[model samples]
Every structure is written in C-alpha cells, then in structure tokens.
Target: MSMPGLSTGTIAARLNRMPITRLHFRMIVALSLIFLFELGDLNTFSYATPGLIKYWNLSVSSVGVIVSASFFGMFLGAWLGGWFSDLVGRRKALIWSTAFYSIMSLVNAFTTDTTELATVRFLTGIGMQAMSVTGLTYISEMFPKDVRGRYLPESPRWLEIKGRSQEAEKILNDLETEVETYLGRSLPEMRDFEPVQQSAKVPVAELFSKELRKRTIVLSLAWIFVILGFYGFSAWVPTLLVQHGYSVVKSLNYSFIISLGAVPGALLAWPITDRFGRKQSLFVIMFIVAFCVIMYGLAFNETTVIIFGFLTAMLLQTQTALLYSYSPEIFPTRIRSVGTGFTGGLGRLGNVAGGLLVAAIFNAFGYAAVFIYVAAAFLMGGFLIGIFGERTAKRALETISK
Candidate 1:
C-alpha cells in the first residue's frame, strides 16, 4: 500500500529535517519510563539475594545458579524478541515483552523455595531482555539521525521498509505539522537524497553475510566482554560485601548509595556521545571503568569501596547507555533488531558465564581475584570496540550501515 511518489528516500529526508517538537519529548518521556522500570526490575534479584540467604539459607553457590538461570532466560529473550519485532513490528513486540516480564515479576514474589524462585527469575529475564532489545530498535528507527540519543510513534522508516509507505507518509505529515505548529515557522526544505532499496525479507543468517560478518563478530565479542564485566560486578557487590563481614543491611545501604551515581553517569553521555562519537566515547569510558573496578576491589575500607564503586557504577552505565544507542545503528533497518538481539543475546551468555566465574573465583581465589577477572573483562571489551567499532555520531543510519 505504498503511495506513488512517496519513496523511502523522501521519508528519510523529511524525518531528518523535522524539528524537535513536544511530541518527540512526549515519546521520550514514555520510553524513559519503560527503561526505568526495566532497569529497576533487572536488579531486584541481586538486591533480594541477601534476604534469601538469611531467611531461606541459600548457599552462595545456589545464588549463583539462580543468577545464571536469569541470564540464560535473557539470552533467549533477546534473540527471540529481536526476531519477533522485525516480523510483527516494534510496537507489538514491545507491548508483549513488557507485559510478559511484569507478570513474571509478580509471580516471582510468590515463590517459596529456591527452585520456584529460579524458574520465575528465568522467565522474567526473558521478558526483560526482549523488551530491552525491542525498545532500543524502536528508538533507532523512530528518531531523526542527528538527535536520536536525545528522542516514536511506529517508525516511519520501518513502515516504509515494510511496504506500508502510505501509512509512513501520514505519520511523517502529522509529525511535520506538529513541529511547524509548535515553532510557528516553516521548516527548511529537505535536500534531495537517494532512496535506499528495501529488501523483501531478511533472514537472520544475513547478519553473517560477507558484507556484515566482520561487524557481527566484532560487536558480539565486544558485547560479551562488556556485559561479562558489568553483570559480574553489579550483581555480586552487595552479596560479596555481606560475605566480607558487613551486615546485610549495611551492604544494601552502601549499594544503594553507590547506585545514586547511575543517573548522572547516564546523563553525562548525552553530550559527549555526540561530540566525541560513539566508538571513541565507549572506548574511553570502558577503560576508565576497568580501572575503577580494580580500585573498587583494592579498597581496604567501606568508604573507599563506596567511592570506587560509585565511580564504577557511573561509568559502567555511561558505556551501557552509549552501547544501547550504538548497537542498533550498526545494521540495516531490515535486520537491525536481529543483529542487535544476536549480539545482546551473546552478551547475556557472557553474563551467565560471569555469574559462574564470580562464584568460582570468589570461592577459590578470594576477593581480589574476582575483581581482576572483572577488570580484565572490561579491558578486553574496551580494546575490541576501540580498535574495531564504527563511528556513528551524527551520521544517518543508512549511511553508517552502508
């Protein structure tokens, strides 16, 4: 149902030139809420572990098993969600995934034993990851190239690719009208641009096609290392502190205090990502975070631990936010979700491994060894992306992918 003269190129050009409007802000607010709940849910299990151990008498190894279960579920969810989104549209996929996780989280409260808890957690992980991958894909498609990090209706770009150009045109027309009404000025005319030809259907295996193979491998490895470091550190900090002889309440309180840095950390990326470019920003942040992780491990007292932990939390989130923006930009629209999901899913696998590594290392080699492993993970992740990732700031998605 494409309208004659309404090519994908025209849609892209119009979207690129559209001014930021209240509607865009509204969309950002809505999406931010989604991420807020998603992240809060992601850490709930980590926070609950101290209580589970005290009340249920769960062993540290048992806690690690539960953690791995959740990550395994996330691995499946990320891959499946991405594939489903491309097939059914981003809106539907997001809605389904969000609802799935929310219900599973509630179900989690009723579990009375380790087995039940692990099962529910695994299910919740799937939904959480699916929602995350879909939401990121939706953002990449709906926002303008120049300011995407800063802002969806159903993406006009996605619609056009799906051969629903008439609907895409209507959405663009509405957006333009809203922007013009808000500004009380006519927007500048769009420059001529070549249309990107749409593929009818893209198979998941296309991510490994000769044109994309290197990107897929490099990004997948980078994601694996980064996520391994992230989950290894964040998931274990509170539990480890308790094991180190701090009271459970003190560990949770300190973890919360350290977490206060997450918001500012994510916000700091907003300007720098556009200024320094995604690859460069990610590169610098990852290395800094690696050093912070080691320092956090070496701290001899509670104060130093909190300080280094706060710094680590902040920078870790900064890189995370940047990666969410960068990952979707790496693929063409036809397979953007699939590629993102695949890499992100592999990263979840890394988390699974991290959970086990944390347990094994903490038990076998003691405290400092665990941090060394986590630090090494971050360093590897940083080097991979610094050396191999594409520059994506201020560039059109189509241009970057090409």
Candidate 2:
C-alpha cells in the first residue's frame, strides 16, 4: 500500500523547509474561528445555568446531572471523532463535526424543559468535542513540525499514509507554487528522504502495546486532571460567586473580565513553548494556576477575587493551548488522531466527574473547599506531566514520537 516512489519523509522535508506564506495565515485565521466557536458553545450552558436554576426551579443536583450528561457525550464524541478522522480524513471529519455541533446548538435554543435541554446539550457536547479533537489533529498534521496550527486542505502527510501519494504530491505542489509566487522566488530545494513505513490502518489496541502504553497513560492522566480542574473552576465559578453573595449580574461581569485574560494567556505560550520547551512551560503554568485557584478561593473581596480569578483563567487557557500542541506530537502519523482522541475522551470523563465533585464539595464543605479540590487536581496533573512527559519542542514528529 505504499506510494511507489514518494514517501512520508519527503513530504515532511518539503513541508518543513517551506517558508511561511499568506496561506498559512489564512489557515490560522480559519482554525482560530473554529476554536472560538467551539469554546463559546462549550461554555454556553454554564453561563445559562444560573438563569435556568431560577426559571426552571432546578436544584444544584439537577444542574450536576445536566452538566455530567454533556460531558458523557463529549467522551463519546472525542473517541469517535478521532477514530473517524483516522478512518476517513481530517477535512471530512472536521466539516461533519462542525455542522453537527452548529445545528445542535441551534436546536438547544428551542428546548423548554430540563429533560429537553439536557438532551440537546448532550448532543451539542458530542459535536463540540469532535470538532475540537479533529481540529487539533488537523493542525498538528498540516503544519511544519515546529509551527503547528490548520484548514480545509487535507494533510499531505495523511494523504501519503493513506496511499494517496499522487494527491499528496499535487497538494504539496500547489502549496509550493503558492509560496513561490508569494515570495517572487522559488522555494528551497526539497530533499528526497527515506519514507516512514506505516500500516494502512492502526488498531485501537495498538495504543496499549508495549511501545505506546506508557505514553497512553501519561497523556490520559494529563488530560483527565487538567480537564477536571478546568471545568471544576470554570463551570461553577459564576454560580459559586452568586452563592458567595455577589449579585448574578456582578458574578457574570467578573466572569467576563476574567475571561478577557485568557487571550493573553494563550498568546504567552506561543513564544515560550519552543524556547522554554513544552513540558517545562506547561508544568510551570499548571502549578502557578493551581496556586492562583487557591488564592481566588481565599480572596475575601471583589478586587482580590477578580484578580486571582483572572490569573487562573489566563494560565489555565495557556495550559490548554499547550496541551493541544503537545498531544498529537506524542503519537505517530498512523494513529495520531486516535491517540489524541483516546486521551481526550478519558479527559471528558474527568469533566463528568468534576461536575459531581464540585456539587458535592460545595454542598458539604462550602466554596473554599471546592477550590481546594480543583487546585489539587491541577497540581496532580502538573506533577504527572512534569515528571513523565517526553520533551517535544523543536523536534520533528517522526523523530519525537518514533
């Protein structure tokens, strides 16, 4: 099933040497919009929870059940999305998942009862996670090893793996031509290299094989704890603030201000991920965010609460962006999506458990206890990755993962 002459190595070399062009910018813009929509939709239900509690007379337990349902859906979606992407191609998977979530989000607006709303939210979570998982994998595959990011165009590396070398070549040719025209000069000469031989299909069980099992465990644990900590704080903060005596409007406003910090937090990772290295940067951020979470919990005034909360949100998002880049790089091209998906799916389970944990801790021990629990999760996640994660910065995917 190998391409007669062309190989993955040649494709990679060509891609790696190409200079950035307007095409890369366009793809970045498109992928950023997709992520923006996905994150926005993912948080919609959380923002609506307080209003729903008042309007529908829903209890805290009911809210937990509803949030848990959505996360369960995300669990299924992450696994299926990765499997589907590997089976078909990233572009088709991305399109289908995006459409699925977008339509479901619209349907969510029409739901009236608790049962109806929960069901729709569950469906929406599937699409949201699917789109997110696919986007991450696509970004990892399409861009140079050092400059990960996405798009409509299928990954030439993926195409070559699927025995579509001719198509992959054509796409690469188009990219080369586009870059050449943009630069008003030909690209650097591409060097032919040995192709990596990959199976046409990789079974899911391969993730547990001797060579991959350690990676599987490490990545899964990282995803699970980080997600648990993130959702624990983000999903409950507004309601928790309201419970702590802030007006609903004031809580929402503070949440909005804290969220603005996320942009810069994510941006901060761009330079340091390569310079300081992914594992180091992520580890430092995670521990710092954990400390910030604890501080936010202990803050007695509006000013301290907002300040600490803003720091937590910013650093948490930085951790998120780094993970997206790190996850796919930990696997080979043949099983990249599935590997990322499997870990991410497990993380969704953590999200599910996080909801219940928040409700229980808040009900039994109060607001500060809940933040302490979340901080612990972040600390554990950081410890796992910092101690065990492979160094991936500035390394080629094949060299890093292989």
Candidate 3:
C-alpha cells in the first residue's frame, strides 16, 4: 500500500509548507454552508414554539419537554458520531449525518402534533450533533497550522496515529499537487516530522487515563456550563422579551436584530484566537456575555435592551467560535474525535437542563431569575477555563496533550 516517493512524514512536511490556496478556501466555504443549514434547522424550534403552544394549548412543562428532547438525542449522537468518525472515516460520518438530518428536517415540517414534532426533532438532533462533532474533527485534521508551529499540524500526523500512513501520504500529495497546479510552481521538498505509525487503535478509555483526567474533567464541566449558558439565553431571548412587556412582534424583531451580531462576532474571533489563545479569549467573551445578559435583564427601555442584547449575542458567538476550535485541540490525534465527542456529548446535558431550567424559573421567578442563572453559568464556565485551560495557541496538538 505504498505510494512511490511518499510517506506520512513527507506528506505533512509538504502540506505544512504549501500556501493557503483557493482550494482550501472553497472547501471551508462548502463546509460553512452545511453548518449554516444545520444551524437554521436546529433553531426552528425556538421560533415555532410560541405558535405551537397557542395552537395546542401546551403547558410550560410540555414545551420544555419538546425543547429538551433533541438534546438527549444530541448527547447520544455526539458520542456515537465521534466513535463513527474514528472508526469509519470523517467523510462518511459527515455524509450520513447530513443526509439523515436533511430528511428528518423535511419530515419535521409536516408534523401535526407536539409529540410528533418532538420525535422528529429528537431524530434530527442526533444527526445535527453528529455532524457538528464530525465537522470539527475533520477541520482539525485537514487544516495545517494557521501560525507556524502554533496550531494543529497537518492531517498526516493524525493519519499516522491511526496507522493510515498510505492514505495520509496520498491526501497530502493530492492537496499539494492541486495547489501546485493552481500556483504554476512546484512545492519545495521537506523532511517528515511524524513518527512511525503505531499498530494498535486508540481506546476510548485512554481519554480518562492519568494523563488526561484533569483536562477531561475540566473540559466536561466547562462544556456543560458554557452550553447551558449559551442555549439558555439564545433559546428564550424572544420569549423573555415578551415576558418583559414587549409585544410578541417587537420581541421577535429585537431577537432578529441581535442574532445578526453572530456573523461579525465569528469574523472577529478568527485573528483573536490565533493572537490571544483560545482559553483566554473564551474567558473574556463569556465574562462579557454574563455582564451583557445581566444588563439586558435590567434594561427598562427598548434602546437599552436592544443594545445589551446585541452585545450579548456578539460575545456569545465569539466564545462559541473559540469553543469549537479549542475542544478538539486539547486531545492527541489517536483519540481526538472520541475525546471531542465525549466532551461535546456531555454539553448536550447542559442544553437539556438549561431549557428545562429556563422554563421552570421563568414560570416561577420570572425573567430576572433566568438571567441570574444564565449569568452564573457563563461566569462559572469562564472561571474553569481561565484557571485550568492549556495554552494551545502556538503549539502542535500532540505537543499540547503532553
């Protein structure tokens, strides 16, 4: 299974030295479109819940159940998706998840009852979560370091981990040859950096070994709390505003305005992630989200509420962009997908709890109590990462694990 004049190490060396080309940009854009549609489908519940509640005369608890159902599926989906990615391949995992979710989403549009909708949403959740985990894992494996020696190394390093050096070599050579064709020049020869491939597969239990235990615990907690805070706020913003005396239309309008902040926030986090490091950036953004959300709760006027709401949305997106990038970087190549899946899967617990908590709290104590709870969740997530997170800005994934 050898390719002439190609090895895993040589592939990595060549890929690392090649420039970011149109091919890379196009692939990222394609992936982004998939992410966009997935996000759109996932968020439909929040927007449609009010109408469903009125039409069905659903109780708060029932609404909460509908909201939380997908999260349970997400929990299982993420874990299994990670395992699938590691066992089968990223492309196949991604394709299956995408196809499954797309069909489920169409079915969801035709649901006639809350129970039916909830069931469809749960199935869609599994596909959506699995796709997300696979996407993050794939990107980390495919991309080279953004800053020399500061981010993930090329895919060859990870391919070598799975004893797929031949495939690794082919991928790298294919990428380099494509780029070379575009550039009308040959890539420079370089020495390989990967060690020889190992024969054994990485076990899931290895993520909890003595070396990664603390990181695993910290990351699990952080994911749970961060996701709790993020989904809690985003899922209920419009409803919370309505409860605060704004008309339903006004509440929806404000939510739309604030949601627009996500695009800029994502754009802004890119350079900041490479410059300030993932952990610190996440801490600052989450802390800001806490502040802004608290302020949003206290605002008496539309102008103030809109301003704070926009700020909160922006900062939350900033934190999310970093979180997605940081999650997979903390593990070694052998178990990257598994570790990512496990942590992310646990975060769905928070998502489920957060939705239920928000409904219970809003029903009893009102919007202020909800924000206070959300603020605490964000602050706690910030504290965990700030105190214990590793510095992974300018280092290889393998180096960071040690």
Candidate 4:
C-alpha cells in the first residue's frame, strides 16, 4: 500500500498544519528511530558475536575483517544515497533505508558464521544513511530563512571576524575561518580552501570533480575516527556489561539506561549546537564522553555504574541531535543528501572497524583494555574536532557542500 507522498509545494503549503517545526519534528522521528534501530541492530551483533564465534569457531581477525564488510556496503550507499535522494526526494530515501535495514536486521538473526553475518550486516549498512542524510536535508528545507541566514548572535565563529554583523556574512566568515583554522593546523597549507570557497557557486559535478579530490579527503577525515570510536564502544556495551558479572537482564537493563539518556541528550544537542557551533559543541561533548567511558569501565557499585552509564548514553544520544542537524545542512539542496550519505556512510566504516577492533581486543586484552581503547577513540574524536571541525552554529547549507 502506498501512502501519499507530499510534494515540496504541498508540504510548504501545509506548513501551518505542523504543530512543531517540521524540520525538527521530522528529524525527531526519523533520526531518533534510525538511532534506536541501529543501536538495536548493532547490539544484536554484539549479543550474538560471542555465540557466533563459538559456534563457528571463527578467529578474531576473521571476525574483524568480516565485521568491516558492512562498511563496504555503507560506503557505497552513503556516497550514493545523497545523490539518489537529491534525484528523487528526501522522503523516499528514508522509507527505503529504514525498510531495507529493518528487513536485513531480521536476516541477521539467521546467520551462521562470520561470512553470512558480514553479508547480512553489509546489506544492512547499505541502508545505513537512508534516514540520516535525507532527514538532515529535509530540516534545512523546512526552517525559516531567519534560521538559515543568521549565525547565533553570540555563537563563536570558527574564526574571529571584526565588525561584520550581517548574519550571512558572519556565517560565511565563520565557515571560512573554521576551514582555514582546521587546514592551518592539520592539513598542509599547500592548497587553499578552494572547495570551501567555491561552495558558494560550485556545481555538484564540479564539487565531486577530480579537481576537488582534496575536498573528499577532508570530508573522509571528518567522520572516520569519531564514528569508529562511538560505535565501537556502543557495540560492545552489552557484552561488556555482561562480562561485568551482570546477568543478561541486568546487562540489557544497563544498555536500556544508556539509550534512555540519549533522548534528553538529543534534545540538548539541537539548541546548543544551533547556538554554539558544531565543532565546539562536539569537542565539549566528546571530552565529557571520554570521562564517562572511563568511569563506566571502573565503576562497580550499582549506583556508580548506572550513573556513568547514563552519562555515556547522553553523549551518544547527542549525535542524533547534532550529527543529523548538521550533516544535511552543510550541503547544497541538490547534493545535500548525497554529501550526508557519503559522510554518514563513511562513519559506518568506523562502526565496522570498531566492531572488529573491540572483538580483537576483547579476548586478548580484556574488557578494561577494550574500553580504554574506546576512550582513546573518543579522545581522538575530541582532538579531531578541536583541530578540524568548524563552528557550524546558525550556518545553513547551499554553499557548505561544494
């Protein structure tokens, strides 16, 4: 049965019917559902990893490599999903990715060994960013120009500008400064930010052209480690909790507590990120997450465990708010979803890598070692944000993608 999909004109016409901001409301449902689904989807793997390993007698390296397989699918899907979404529209991608992953998730339950499991996960990853990229762009489309044109008045632009008060100019300056600052520190200053510059008028074909190889590199670096870190720790949380001498019920309970934290955290991320800027907001959250991860590892008392666990959830959930809010808003309307899918898809590579990384360290080093590794991942995320991420508060897309 097909439900009527609204045209942009139709949607725009009915804007008054929406009780909340359509963009926010769409993201609230779409991103939140995807987050919850992926959490459960990844957790299903974690819960089943041990069983699969024992049943199949798979080696750690084998599982690690197998785990990464899903990323291959996600990589293709993410980079391409945006294009597809732009070509068709935002809504289709969401419905398709969600439907695809939902079905693939069930398929995972029937897996035999690393091969079959990876295959299923791979298919699952193909749908990984369906909701993410499209949902992001939809938000950008829904908001008022006032929301788009102005940087939060008090928001720190990535670079300091003197005397520029025009909100759009301020935003452009912020984007430029953030790009320059990141390139100044991390990248060789060999090439200036042509992509960032051209974003103002660069066409999608031009943005994705051979001339802009550097842009692709910058984008890849943006999402990889941070994503890997977040997913790696999360994928193993249920397993780690179980290994902490907690029963399955307790382990599930702990994970539930963590997920619940993300709900409020997600809400917090939108306004704060909208006001402060993405890079700053992310760095702040990552720092606190690092601390929470360490606390989660050492805490033994029930109260301490639950408390730290909730903190971890808060940090993780904030992604739903910031990542989704930020991703699509950074690209052109034509290619917004594509850029989002690509980056998000690239992030899933980290998820695949994290799964394997945790799997490798789990038996060899111990849960504590695994978590420390996770903490290191978060630390890298913080470092990367401090170095590369621009403050994106009050900034809109249309030019950021190029």
**Taking the candidates one at a time, how many backbone clashes does each contain?**
0, 0, 2, 4
**RMSD values, in order shown:** 1.9, 2.4, 3.1, 12.3
Clashing pairs in 2: none
Model 4 lDDT per residue over 164-199, tens place: 124324433444455446455422222111111212
What value does the lDDT take at residue 303 in candidate 4? Answer: 89
Model 1 global lDDT (CA atoms, 0 to 1): 0.86
Give lDDT tens digits, candidate 3, residues 1-402.
Answer: 234444334544555566777666766886788899987975666766656656787766787787788888888888989888777667788888889878987898898888898898899888888898988877766666554312212355556666776677767767777888988887655543543334246578978899998888899999999988888888878766766777767878888898888888888787798889888888888888999989988887889888988888888888888888888888876778878989989999668876788889989998788888999999999999999987777565545767
Better of 2 and 3 by TM-score: 2
Better of 1 and 2 by lDDT: 1
Error of 1 at 285 (Å): 0.5
Candidate 1's C-alpha runs over 4 A off are: 1-4, 192-194
lDDT of 4 at 131: 52
lDDT of each: 0.86, 0.84, 0.78, 0.59
lDDT of candidate 2 over 39-112, digit per residue (tens): 88766667888788778888777888888889988988999999999889899999999999999989988998
Off by more than 4 A, model 4: 1-40, 43-66, 110-114, 145-219, 243-249, 300-302, 399-402
- The TM-score leader among the candidates is 1
lDDT of 3 at 312: 89
Worst 10 residues of 2 by lDDT: 1-10
What TM-score would each prediction reach against the true structure?
0.97, 0.96, 0.92, 0.70
